[model samples]
Target: MPGARRLLWLIPLALVVTGGLAAGATFLGADRIESDLTARTRDALVAAELPSATVAFDGRDASIGNVPADQRGRARSVVLGVAGVRTAEVTGQPAEQAPEAGGHVKRDLQVRLDQLLAAEPITFQPDTAELTVQGTRSVSRVADMLTAAPANVTFEVGGHVARVPGGDPEGARTLSEERARVVANKLVEAGIAEDRVRAVGYGDTRPRSESGTTDLDRRVEITVR
Candidate 1:
């Protein structure tokens, strides 16, 4: 009878130990899974040769922020190949130029601004807006451009957006306009004359990209008039 009682005690003890082992195993498994996913996703981004290799993984949905100039798709495909990555979403602009024409100083400044926009690509985060590292570089170039331009020249910082397909045209326009405003503010902070610069949002009305299906359609254009 005493042995029987001891056996019952051992049964409970064994069950507790087994339960703890199971829990520990589950935790380790989960951790391994997450680590594997993160590693694979990061590797895919590197393989894609994406410019901005910043990745935001939300479960099955993975988003890349900084794509290099000419290899966005290649990078995206690598991510898609990962078993758990359901989608590889790109959330930034490409680093490209749309040609240019201006005198030495003006052309130089314009090129600088273009470089900034291409690298930083204005991102509106909160009540207070700030430029990314790339933005800072580009804005510095614009400031240089303004300094290089005629001291008394007046400039208009206009905003423009690509038209949305089957979406709210007015809303898109407003957003683009606001984006313009933000860019203007950055330019002003970089030392452009306040009176010389003005920001106007065009919102999806004047689109550089007509299709409106691509991220390029949603862009910020700066026209210094």
Candidate 2:
């Protein structure tokens, strides 16, 4: 009877050990994590009705590609709302200059900015908003252009960045915005009224350069707004 009692205790103990091993295997499994990430990402996209968008997971960061530029914000919102995602990247075609000018700096600068920066593009630090010596010189020319611009017209300085792999999207955004502001401040110092200038950044979303990481892409584009 004592042996029978000990056997019964051993049975429950073995079950507990087996259960722990199974649980540990599931928790420590790479396939399991990947499967979970994929499911969670896809479910969020589907729930948001974003069938066309797909997410790539790197650690906890999710890069969602094939999203339209206009829908980028919604895509990010959807993915960031998902648990276990650290950062979200919404990528697709680079944003284009507006079909016509007004409110959108992209549209206004497509042709006009080229005319201004035709000689040399403005250059910034690899991951910063700081202007290089050459960058400051480039903006001096832009100041001249703004000086000729009519006071009735307002100009917006749009900043851009190339999406570097593993780069921080938020950092890119901050750099771009600060770069625009830098150029805008320089133009103001050059005699443009503060009220007549608007500064904005589009980060890596609206790449003008072919490779997206050229001095050309990291430029301050001027648009009549």
- Clashes (backbone N, CA, C under 3 Å), per candidate, total 9, 3
TM-score of every prediction relative to native: 0.41, 0.48
lDDT of 1 by residue, 1-225 (tens): 999999999999999999999999988886776677878887655444332366766656777766655667776777788898778876788644323434565556666666766665543432223344554465566666664465445566655555444767677666666766777776665555566677776665655454644444444555444
Worst 10 residues of 1 by lDDT: 123-132
> What is the lDDT of every predicted structure here?
0.61, 0.76
Q: In the order shown, what is each candidate's alpha-carbon RMSD?
A: 17.1, 16.9
lDDT of 2 at 63: 82
Best by TM-score: 2
